[model samples]
Target chain A: MARLTKIKTRKKGGATEILVLVNHPMETGQRKNKKTKKKIPAHYIQKMVFKIDGKEVADANLGPAVSKNPLVGIRVAGVKKGASVKITWSDNKGESGKAQTTV
Target chain B: MNTIRRRTFLKGTVASGFAAVAATSGLLRPTEVMAAAWPKSAFKSKKLDKSIKNLFGSSKVTASKAIKIKAPIQAENGAVVPLTVSTTMSNVEAIGVFVEKNPSPLATSIDLTGATAFYSARIKMGKTSAIHVIVKSGGKLHVAKKTIKVTVGGCGG
Candidate 1:
């Protein structure tokens, strides 16, 4: 799955607002492999990091229980109107994707 | 007296055997049995380090409560669950969702631009696990998490 779509950031009060869309399958290990007639091993994204203007701001540890194509909302303080923000995420399979935006 | 003693011994032997059998069978829950039967190599990944670096850069992330994740305490269907993450902080840059128990864990990541802060979306749940929300604000990381129980697993169960 891909990360970050339709990203938008705006000014709200004294801080900047942000919105985003994420694409992911988020498969749990319980599923079966159709071709092999065996169970597919569990594989899901496990970590995510969010940064604004090169500074670490947020991080998360994930598990298999989350749903697919998950969406998230966040607000940060002291961000400028045109500053850049970067988002990165990784899964158990060692797959990673990145998205960046300017507020 | 000999006959009564013989009967009691037989009864004791039978009870012990039954208890042993019950104990052995109790160890086999359907989920545990299924997991054990599956091969471990099927889920192994070789690119874990590269993936992490590519996504989060080299900086370490801290835990905070600037973000909130809203999900069902118990999901009836694991295939689809409605989830929402919202934060009150300003100058937000990005948000991410994670499942703590999934083999791959990192479910989705999103980046935002301009200054707008609110977002909403639906995601799939395979099993019961914790959901995490991470946000970036003013160059610092803020996070929140919630546990969700998934019933009727979505992974083709």
Candidate 2:
């Protein structure tokens, strides 16, 4: 299935707050498929970046320990309303996805 | 089926130590490196203390009531346990989550530049374990943890 990423931005006080959620199995390569009963290979997002107005504000490194459809929240200083915020993530399978929104 | 899957899990666990090193070596090729910025040693360490030091540069974390971890006291499944960590403390720089009994203790470390005192994520747990939430603020490390029982396997069973 194709991964889905969602981004939401809001201006709070003097900073822009962004929240992200991505859909993926986040398989640790350690689980078994119920019917076939074979171990499912590991497939999970490894890195994510958050940008405000094309400028990188923050990022994260994740492992399979993260839950499926992971959620993250971040804030950047000095961003005004209508400022663009973009988020992108790459997984272990070399698959990548992104989403964007405005504050 | 059970024995076969258990063997597979055992093999993955054995190779995971090397997996972390390979992830950092950049020997896996350029494209792979671009996708890998994960702290190799931190996620590979089996010991919680070692992983904490590898990520935070110090294991001397003080217990704090200011940090609160919101998770179910009993999780029905180990695969997708939702957690939210919020702190009343200010000037927070980063937040990290660690499962004390996972094959690798350090799950993920998130860096915050101008973020608030709240962060949330879904975490995988192999079995029952304590979730350690570490908050870095004012150059000091403060922590809180919650133990959750996992009924189903998130990692290999």
Q: How many residue pairs clash in each candidate at the backbone level?
A: 46, 4
**How far in Å is the alpha carbon of B95 misplaced in model 1?**
13
Against the true structure, what is each candidate's TM-score? 0.47, 0.78
* Candidate 2: residue pairs that collide: A29-A42, A30-B156, A67-B122, A67-B123
For each candidate, what is chain B's TM-score? 0.60, 0.76
Candidate 2: docking tier: acceptable
Error of 2 at B132 (Å): 0.8
Q: What is the interface RMSD, in angstroms, for predicted model 2? A: 4.5
Model 1, docking class: incorrect
Which stretches in model 1 have alpha-carbon errors above 4 Å? A1-6, A10-15, B1-77, B84-156
Error of 2 at A41 (Å): 2.4
TM-score of 2: 0.78
Tens digit of per-residue lDDT, candidate 1, span B1-157: 9997567566655754653454347564422322222111112222333222233442246676666666789989867777777777887765655555555454555455543454455556557987766666675656677889987766566
